[model samples]
Target: MPEADGAGEQVGVGPWSGGSPPDDPRYDPELLAHGDRRNVVDRYRYWTVEAIRADLDARRPPDRHLHVAIENWAHDLNIGSVVRTANAFNAAGVHIVGRRRWNRRGAMVTDRYLHLHHHPDPAAFAAWAAHADDGARLPVVGVDNVPGSVPLEGRELPARCVLLLGQESSGLTPEAQAACDVVVHITQHGSTRSLNAGAAAAVAMHSWALQHA
Candidate 1:
């Protein structure tokens, strides 16, 4: 860079000049091409999307997965929080069952790396999971505090499975409730009837990531 001197002569700019590109590798070129103000960590400052995905693909273990599923009964705010949480956990994908559109405000730009899928109903989610791993038969795990549920800590989660979460006020519906191969619950010490949908989704996703990822 250069600067103009008093006599209009070109002077070289000093090193103190505040202009430098980011050094992170995960940053997408598309983002850089546009400006590179993404919400990703510093490690992914200025890079191309293809470059980041290629790097992750090379380093990620084949069996490591963090799948998050949310039942969008009426487009709740918890859905956005859940998506953000799944992104934090580096989930393999996000399954949204219900309304085709969801609020992206709470995602905080994390949705870029997180894969999202839409399903009209629980059956559709199940169908995708059934053939998830090239027809290898993956389990669809559900999270709820129902009587017949299992403790997430005591069991191991599969790498390629759907972890389903119900709506906020009303948990999973009859059909949705019965579609789980296994249901897990988060231990609550308070008088609340159950945990918030977003909180429960985070806990379940973390537990599953610990076991499988």
Candidate 2:
């Protein structure tokens, strides 16, 4: 296995474009027919769908952390973007709460590397997380810039916690907010009501890594 930098990170492929005609039977037909081209690294290009799935399954970490997104209504274009960010961060898993369908355009096919779980609602995600770990019951942390949110920079983050993100526009639902053990805020200088859901998730995940990767 190739090692990442001291920061516990690995670099993706560059200067490689999606090649190899998808005429091969092993690759995902959907991806082949559609434009799978994106800024993604070269390692994934033209790879068989089953091959990629198997590879991802083998690479999954047993002790890795979790990240969740509350889809709520059909307004989660940020979900795919968040998934892409999660892939860049190499999160243990991604939990999607609410609508099953999301905009894959933003994911840019990085979803191939992520282990995704689905929860019907926020309450369901909370319940699963509560018992997901034997005694630990992975801590649920919400990321938002709301008025009462705690500063993420100074706070201690859990090693195996689940970072929860709300929908792109509405933010977290009441049920999701109530389920979080702590609500964290990402400090910003620019005047805005809130940050983009995908951007917020990336910042939160990186913050967690800085504290306790």
Candidate 3:
């Protein structure tokens, strides 16, 4: 397993050493000629971006039907981290409500591998969810610890549902919460008021994966 590295530490493999590169079309000639230093799995070391995305799409199981929605009204930095986690979990798609342009630094370029959508506001997002292209009206499950919320533990998330999260500082705007079919919250033993948006997203995604993935 490749260990996570900090700045200045070498990552990924060097250029191919063989006389001729593989004839496979999926392989990127430039990467093969030079080196594959992108932070990717070993299987995708020299693969082109399009090839990697296509492979991932082909291998995705139908049962892996979870989607993620983030409220980007504030251009929250946590949005990028949430996107990276969504990619890790192989979410069906990611929806950005409110602002289209978000801080992507925390994503580390993982967004390129996932399908993304943008909505003008929570109402627009909710409308789309009600009549998605697939014909399945996916439930919008909000993750926040506001009033009248239920604990997420042991909860059975819908197989084809969207996990919605709000901005880091002000979680789940009234409009966003109103758009949700059901609101769930993570149980905490610590004294902290609430979990960070990124951490909360990971926990909610993991919980859904545990139940359905």
Give the per-residue lDDT digits (tens) of candidate 1, residues 1-213: 122334656433222223554455654434554444445554554555556556555655767665788888786888888988987777777888988888876775566667789999988877787788767767778888887888887788887777889889888766777778988888878899999998898888888767766
Task: After superposing candidate 2 on the true structure, give the runs of residues whose Cα lies further than 4 Å from its correct spot.
Answer: 1-64, 134-136
Please write out the lDDT profile of model 2 over residues 92-144, one tens digit for every residue.
77888887777776776668667788898988988988887665588899887
Estimate the lDDT of model 1.
0.73
Candidate 3 lDDT over 1-213, as tens digits, reads 222345746688888997789999999998898788877889898899899889888876775588899998786889989999998998878999998899987887889889999999999999999987377688999999999999999888888889999999899999999999999999999999999999999999999888877
Better of 1 and 2 by TM-score: 1
Q: Model-by-model lDDT, in order?
A: 0.73, 0.72, 0.89
Off by over 4 Å in 1: 1-35
Top-lDDT candidate index: 3
- Let me know the TM-score candidate 3 reaches against the reference structure: 0.94
In model 2, state the lDDT of residue 40. 45
- Model 3 segments beyond 4 Å from truth? 1-5
Better of 1 and 2 by lDDT: 1
Candidate 2, residue 108: Cα displacement in angstroms equals: 0.8
